[model samples]
Target: MAEPGDTSVLATAKAKSQKSHELASCVIKEPLFSYAHLQVLNGNPLQEPIELDALQVRSYCTAALQQFLGIAGTAISIDILKVDGSDCWLRVPRDSLGAFSAAITAWRGTNENGVHTTFRVKGCSDWLGSLVGQVGQDTLWSK
Candidate 1:
């Protein structure tokens, strides 16, 4: 109903809002290293050699691994699976692990080094539909 003295613009605005594209925008950056250490400060008991400290190589500590990924503008969300066969191992490099931080409020990106690398975890590594991973210190990757 239109009142004679009131020219309401909201009615038309409501109609336009109803037909949306259903698309939510997100920031996308390219990958950084061919192989990098992904931290297990957030551990996954589902994978073998999971205790990275038990390994004999010079590996980045979990905290450092998260930080390196942060500097590269990527979040490491791992999905560990206890599969029976050869599909169970993710042979990440010794430097693949990185550090996590509280100052890292949002996943940020940059490409200032003349490199168009993508900062991403494989889509399978989406933990809890969010960037940060915390499994009460004793977690398992379900992928």
Candidate 2:
């Protein structure tokens, strides 16, 4: 049996407690990227469905950035993660999320073939999983 004043047992207990605490707490230091879920919309409800390709997505984003922030804004890197129908997923630098979002929001949509199209930012998150979960919820509620 251990004595009440046993320093070795006390140190062992302290070490085990510290390890458990460390395991329970997680600190994500400076996440490198942020994610956004966007949907394309057209002004006319009677128009055909919009199908976005990678090139079109990039062009639209570039135009918005250039319009909002000029050359500097155009320099912001945007990664197209996935494109499905009218919806797209994008990854951008964590530092530029605000500027990117603002650019998309403020720009007037482009008109092509009498169809006016614009991007709507459905959601944004530093963690992609959160944005993905939100998308799932949106689908659930939408149906």
Candidate 3:
């Protein structure tokens, strides 16, 4: 029989096995998505304002993605979180954030006046609440 203070051969082997597993195992990172806050603007400053609802915003975004990324762009998913006036809040895959933003900038939106418009990305974050709590552009001028 082994002494009280002595560990058994099985115990030593089990400890070594656990140590090996701890060393060999790698920490996996959780996938994240970036939430983008976009503002639709009239490209032609001279043209009247073009107000858009949730559907119209999605439609315009779809068109932009189609124009910039072709058929593949359509595969990218977009969730419209909210729409207030000309401002829009949306979410896109974090990995695709760059491509999505680039596509929006590259494409031009046409207003009811037959004039082109632009999509301005005001802010982007992985957390939805962060975007919601952010200050508006007006805050830039505040003391």
Please tell me which predicted candidate would have the highest TM-score against the true structure.
Answer: 2
State the lDDT of candidate 3 residue by residue for 1-143, as single tens digits: 76777778779868877843444766537446778888888767786666769998898889989999999998899999889888898889988888888888887767665766778878887778888888475587895
TM-score of each: 0.18, 0.82, 0.69
Task: Give candidate 2's TM-score.
Answer: 0.82
Error of 1 at 126 (Å): 11
Candidate 2 positional error at 68, Å: 0.5
Q: What is the lDDT of residue 4 in candidate 3?
A: 71
Every candidate's lDDT:
0.31, 0.92, 0.81
Q: Count the backbone clashes (under 3 Å) in each candidate.
A: 22, 0, 1
Give the per-residue lDDT of model 2 (tens digit) for 1-143.
99999999999988877843434766898899999999899999887769999999999999999999999999999999999999999999999999999999997989998889999999999999889888767578678
Candidates sorted on lDDT, descending: 2, 3, 1
Of the pair 1 and 3, which is ahead by lDDT? 3
TM-score of structure candidate 1: 0.18
The list of candidate 3 runs beyond 4 A from truth reads 1-31, 44-48
